[model samples]
Target: MAKHYALASYADGGDWRETEHLYVPRRDTRLRLQSLMALGYTASEVAAATGLSPSHVCNLRTDVVHTTVHVFTADAVASAFRDRWDKLATGPQANRQRSKARRLGYLLPLEWEPGDVDTDDTTEMFLSDPSSPETTENPEVLDYVAIAEAIAGRRVTLTRAELSHAIVTLQDMGVGVHETAERLHTYTRLVNRYRARARQDAA
Candidate 1:
């Protein structure tokens, strides 16, 4: 269910505008955190993004509100969520997983060995062939703030947060939360998710 409100939102000079439909904090922070994870946030990142601790996020998974949710301050959660809210701009990761789930795949190149990519070093190739007559770049990424914003987009958003929280209503379904990224260069899946999602959403 949606939590909505009609408030006399004021303008700079005191002009009032009515707005409706707001999000409510159900006793379900854990479910929301799970959704945020699927959206590509690491546990620590989600905590940073949502302004809660990893333990608190863990508790949300269990709906252990008596121990976790109540201790979270409103300002902290709001700040964390807002930081991630702007991350909402990010659509998906750069590289997508192969359909029919490959048993194995080529490792990314770190350096050129006689023009052949050497994936031994495990360095990521964040570069994309933008002018390859295939992909488009975000206009904001050309500058510093946009790049930072793009990084933040890998977090979560209010919409995702709401969807995450809604899992509690899913007949008490379990939302498994895990973090697989520890090496910075391992964001291939995330980058692909962003790229694919961006492409589809744009279309």
Candidate 2:
């Protein structure tokens, strides 16, 4: 039977010793580690990528070590596996598995690899073709920030702490708390939108 591990997260990070997520051995774990190794990743490399110790990775290859690890650690390992599987997989089974993993948020890395590609001819065609945006400009839409900021005057930058202070200071004058919060939220959102657009245009 496949071993099950329970990994739980906490708001504040703590020592692993404080948690139940640690090695407990099983056959399925060994097979899983071995399979990943067969795909050309060294235990050390995989360990680094997955936030695991090399010894943990190595033991999983030979020992049946299993455990309820932290969700963050499991996520790191899942991400590493997804990238390697997508990059080196040789069959439909691997492709299907990779697709499922991707849907679960284990996305492949964006880097281009010219040497070895396990994907089909369509991938090759895509890589060979010079990449260009399908359309230059986005469909004309109302610029919410532009309209808001034009009426509100040019945006003034403030640190988060400064913004918080401003909100509290305004409330000290007996302004309605809910209205103040709403106005501050709208102001910050519009300012951020304009700043983001400026950066995009500069880029």
Candidate 3:
């Protein structure tokens, strides 16, 4: 008997029916899930990329996410593996994160005076790499606590509704609210102000 046996049935007059089952590798997909989880991708993100439902992806946990028969199509799994591989192998994030200090290189040129005679200087210099600017601790969320503290210190005032509305706007822009608020502590407030100013300028 062959190791790769497929079921078949034969009828009269050379009529026959057969079921072919392709060999699928017996690899654990949960390990892949764990790796992606470590990279901070949510199950929804994985499902979106692999065409799986969010619940299906959520159930991919080998233990808490589930250890039962949560099988996905081999094609979907393979596509996910390839996508991860490509992301790891290419693009801007291929380089490691730069330090906060190094990212603020734009401030260096501001120190030069009017009589600086370096027009012929061949040495390459950059104020700061605009591609990777210095982040003041939080880049995504405006620091509300800090803003509140500052406002208190400076006697600035805005209604609670206004503040909450601004925060809600951030959440609508793919930010996870509270967490991004913390991560973007200072900038969130600045962003709202900047956006409002831009709208005013446009108007």
Candidate 4:
């Protein structure tokens, strides 16, 4: 009797042994997907990069019961993660993705290094990283009242720095000058002045 091996052709047009297609543990792959989502990459973005379905990428990010995945699937996710781990995704969809990941308590890219993703002790290591957002005890709180007054045509008593910070915060949240002025019941000229001051201070 002789040992037998299964063979198949892959997309690269190379015949590979069946052993090469065996499912592998998906812990690292799942973490990588979650980390990318935490960094604001939407499932659709990842799917586009890896040729996986968006729903499949979402499942891999949220599902924990499944313990294994196809080798090719893992490889695709790994390649996508490597290319995007350090980049912060933008746009409404990316913002939603990041919010969902945060609500689900997924680990951030800064929490683990390339080699740490597969290790059981990565959570502990993350806690020790001073630069990690998780370790920030006193994150800067934006001045909501100043922002509200600036938008409502009410007399604002905030300092110059505080008012500038409020304008910048609104800008960062994707609120444009027209919207801010409309909300404040004031002219866009006022909002524009604040925006200009904010930009100058930022630069």
lDDT for each residue of candidate 4 in 69-89, tens digit (9 for 90 to 100): 877787677667655553456
lDDT of each: 0.33, 0.42, 0.37, 0.63
Which candidate tops lDDT?
A: 4
- lDDT, model 4, position 136: 28
Deviation in Å, model 2, residue 81 alpha carbon? 0.8
User: Which residue ranges in model 2 land beyond 4 Å of their true spot?
Assistant: 1-29, 65-73, 89-203
Per-residue alpha-carbon lDDT of candidate 1 for residues 1-203, written as tens digits (9 for 90 to 100): 54333222111122332333343343323433433443345556666665567776655544544533332342244334333421321224312221111222212221112323122111112223322222344433344433233233333222222221222222133322112121112233433434444455459
Model 3: per-residue lDDT, tens digit, 47-161? 8877888786655533444333322343454346433421211223322211221242211122323333122111111122212223122334555655455333232222323
Clashing pairs in 2: 21-68, 24-66, 25-64, 26-64
Which ten-residue region of model 2 has the weakest summed lDDT? 8-17
Cα RMSDs of all predictions?
18.6, 19.6, 21.3, 15.0
Model 1 / residue 79 / CA error / Å: 2.7
Q: lDDT score, residue 166, model 2?
A: 41
Once fitted onto the true fold, the runs of candidate 4 whose alpha carbons sit more than 4 angstroms away are 1-21, 113-116, 119-203
- Model 4 clashing-pair count: 2
The predicted structure with the larger TM-score, 3 or 4, is: 4
| Global Cα lDDT for candidate 1 | 0.33
Global fold similarity of model 1 (TM-score): 0.29
TM-score of each: 0.29, 0.29, 0.28, 0.48
